[model samples]
Target: MHVLFLAPEVWPFKRVGGLAEVAYDLPRALAALGHKVGVVTPKPRLSQEMEQGLERLDTVLEVPVSWKRHLAEVYRHQEPSGVEVYLIGHEHLFDREGLYGNAYGDYEDNAERFIFYSRACLELARTMDWRVDVFHANDWTTGLVPVYLRTLYAGDPCLKDAASLMTVHNLGNQGQFWHYDMPLTGLGWEYFVPEALEFYGQINFLKGGLVFADMISTVSHTYAQEILTPELGRGMEGVLMARRDRLAAVVNGIDYQVWNPADDYRLAANYDRHDPSPKARCRQELMGHYGLEDGGGRPLVAVVGRLEDRKGLDLITAGMERFFEVGLNLVVMGYGEDHYHVALGELAARHPGRLGLTIGFDIDLAHRIMAGVDMLLVPSRYEPCGIHQMQALRYGVVPVVRDTGGLADTVVDQRPGVEGTGFKFEPFTMEAMLQTLDRAKQAYDRPQEWRGLMQRAMAQDFSWQAVAPRYEEIYRKALELAGQRQRA
Candidate 1:
């Protein structure tokens, strides 16, 4: 089977979140499984320096977006794993410092920019000799791929019969635009109804994909079910419930090659599940690097990723005093809302040595933290499928995640005869999180029990090798659905 992935970002070229990592690793995993795979993404300006081996293709695609025609330059790169990556370059649209926008906010033209890229994806596919059995669209940026496939290219030989799978990484970020911008979609105003692209008079790109795609999927089974409720749906629950039959979920996987502690060059000391004694050196280095005073034998807990409200930063802030009292040292990395920056900065200042904070993301620092931290905190209010928890597991850093979404699916709370990998709290409140942390600290004090938990986490597998087959199954089901739709 031949699968084509459409995403706004692909790792090592351009990345903003977990979607990029999924785009990077999943294709290669599928290719290794003996299926032909390809990826289509916009060429961000920064990728030029990173992708030195990129080949400029002779084919120039004239992509139509509403009333305008934009020419897209194609660049090709062949991965060692036999996956083809096609980057569509448009200087005026994509040659920006950031893939979506700068620090100020999201690009105002995000809707128009992605509409052109979605059209270009189909146009580029038309030029290729490869036949795509499934066009996998990721997130809101490429949501229009399925919409266009069913509308504009309905009669086209190459794409008409091809099924589409729209993967919603985060329903909260549905590409919503002003109603006036509906013209940019090149679809009839009739499609602007609530049954299709419309969301409270706004042109919702993700809604269109959900309505038109052969099948829809989210990152984890729990999240798939969560999005159908008013609490987590972000106003798309009714539409999702209307088409729940077509919805499916698979947990996101980590690329062990990139996450394995044994071979990670970024760590100060490398160790696997067999001999994790070297982790002590990594812990010492982490403490020294962050200027954190040694806590005698206190657990070094780290919170990694964006400091946003949904990430439960509020809970962490509320529980800071309790955390310090329980003999736990905390370090936080990743940047987000200004309020969180100020709040966390003030907290870190008020409690010097015990609390350490880094305002931005650093890949090397992330790796070192994974190896060094005794426990990783991922107290998200609602996580689609958290990659950090998976990475923490791979490094034998026990994850203390909220029992919601993918976190619930991945981490098993320790109980008698359970052999769990991590700790889980049910409610999204500071008290619940604190209680879980206290329990984790108790377990930590027991050296033999802690070692057993760490070894169990490392032994568990969440590799793409185990995940890609599930995608292949989804693709086949999508193909069957598309065939039935065509016949009808």
Candidate 2:
């Protein structure tokens, strides 16, 4: 099958979050399965070193947005994994310092920018004579791809028959813009009704995708169910529930090649599940780098990823004193929310050698932390699908994650006689998190049990190779639905 993926961010080119990583890895995984996979993303302002690799195409795509015609230049690059990447370049709209927005917040013209990009994706496919079987749209950024496919490009011979599958990475970001911006979509006001594009008094891009696309998917099975409820739905529950039959969940996968501890050059010393003694060297290096001292063999636990309230950073802050009293050393990485920065910094100062904090993301440091940390903390309030837990498991590092979404699906809670990989807490409370931490520490204190747990985690496989076939199955089902729609 020929699948063309449309996403706002693709790693190595532009990456703001997990969506970027998925865009890069999933297509490569699909290509490896002997299917033709192509990715279309907006070309942002990149470093000169990165830009040299792109081959600018002569074709100028005439994209219609609202009443005006916008011309877009295309750049092509063939990835090492044989996946073809096409970057739609629009200097005024996309050539910015940030992919979505700068430090101020989201770009004011975000709806307009993505509207142009979505239309350009179809134009690129048609111009290149690439017959796309499935136009897999990711998140609200490319949500209109499906809407445009069934509307504006419905009669176009090249793209008319292509099926669309819209994957919602997070329901919280629905791309709700002012109702007046409906004109920017170049669709009639009829689409602005409650049953279609309109949400409350705004134009909702994601809602349109849910209504128009043949099939919809999210990151994990549990999350697929979660979004149908009011709590996690973020006000899209009714639309999602109406199309519940069309919705499915496939847990996100990690690239084992990039995450394998035995082969990771970023680690202080390489080790696998079989011989994890080298992890001690990595642990020492990580501590030395952070100015943290080994606390008489206390288990070292680390929190990685964005430090926001949604990630249960509040729980971490609330339980910090108790966690330290219980003989646990803590290290934090990744940056988010200024309040967390100040709070965690103050805590680190108070605890001196016991607490270590790094305010931003560094890929090299991430690898070292994963390899060295005895336990990885992922107590999210609600996680769609977490990649960190999977990455930690691959490195023989046990995860202590909240029992929700993909974390619940991936991490098996350790119990007596259960061949569990890690620890889990159900309630989203600091007390629950602390209790789970105590259980993990108790297990860590028992060297034999801790080694068993680590080995069990490392043996688990959440690789893209194992996950790609499921996507293929969904694409086939989506094609079936498309055929039914065409017949009607």
Candidate 3:
């Protein structure tokens, strides 16, 4: 099968979050399975310098916007694994310093920008010599592709039978704009109704895809179920419920080649499940790197990612006193809201050598933490699918996560009778989080049980090798659905 992955960003080229990583890993996995896979992403400003091995292609894409023709230069990057990435270049819209927006806020022109990219994706498919079997779009950025295929380019033979699948990484971030922007879609006003792109009084790009795509999927089965309810759906539960049969939930997988502890160059010492010697060295190195004290026998717990409300970071802040009282050393990495920055910094200062805080993202440090830390903290209020917990498990670092979304699906609570991967807690509150941590700490004291838990976690397979076949099945379902729709 020939597949085209349409996303706003691609990993190692333009990345803002886990979506880019998913955009990078999944296609490569599919290609490795003997499928013809290509990724289409907006050309980032740093592409020329960052994309070392890619060569420019002769293909030029001219996409029709509402009234004008938008021209984009096409460049192709062929991975050694046979996956080809086609970058759409438009200086004004894409070649900015940021993938989506700057520090101030999201770019004001995001609606127009992605609209053009979505339209250009379809046009690029029409112009290319190879016909695509599936046009797989990610998040709200590429939402319009399914809409364009069903409406704007409905009669075009090249894509008339091609299936579209919209994978919602986060329903919280639906691309919504004022109703005035609806005219820019080039879709008829009939599509502006409540059942289509319209959400409340606004034009929602994500709704367009949800209504038009042959199928829809979320990163995890739990998330797919969560989005059908009032609390987690972000106002689209009814729409999702209407098309329940077409929705799927497949857990996102990690790129083992990059994340494997046995081969990771970023770590101080390379160790696998067999040899546990280097893991101790890694822990020592992590302590030295953070300027924290060693030989104290305190369990090292690391929190990596955005420190914000949604991440349930406040629960950590609320339990900081208990964290120290229990003789736990905490290392925090990643930047977010200003208040969290100030709060965490103050806590670090108060705790001195016991707490280590890094305000920004460091890929190397992240890998080191996963390798060295005793536990990883992911207390998200609602996580669609977290990549860090998966990476943590890969390195044999037990994840202590709130039982929600992918965390609920992946992490099994370790008990006296049942050997599990990590620790999990329900009820998104400080009390529950602290109690779970206490349980984990109690388990930490039992070396025999702890080792067994680590072994189980490391033995677990979260790689795309196990996940891609499920995606292939969904792709086939999408094709059948598309064919049925066309026939009707």
Each model's lDDT comes to 0.91, 0.92, 0.89
Least lDDT summed over 10 consecutive residues: which range in candidate 1? 44-53
* Candidate 3 Cα lDDT to native: 0.89
Residues 1-488, candidate 3, lDDT per residue (tens digit)? 99999988887787677888898999999998999999999888874466566677788888877787888998888888898988898988887887777878789999889999999888888998567899999999999999988887888878888999999999999999998888788888898899899998999999989999999999998999999999999999999999999999999999999999999998888988776558888888888888897545889999999888889889998899898887789999988788899999999999887889999887888898888899999999999999999999999899999999999999999877778999999899888888888889888888888888888898889999899999999999999999999899
* lDDT per residue (tens digit) for residues 189-257 in model 2: 999999889888999898889889999999999999999999999988988898899898999999999
Point out where model 2 deviates above 4 Å.
none
TM-score of each: 0.97, 0.98, 0.97
Q: Which regions of candidate 3 deviate over 4 angstroms?
A: none
> Which residue segments of model 1 deviate by more than 4 Å?
none
* Candidate 2: 10-residue stretch with minimal lDDT: 12-21
Q: Largest TM-score belongs to which candidate?
A: 2
Winner of 1 and 2 under TM-score: 2
- How much is 248 displaced in model 3, in angstroms? 1.1
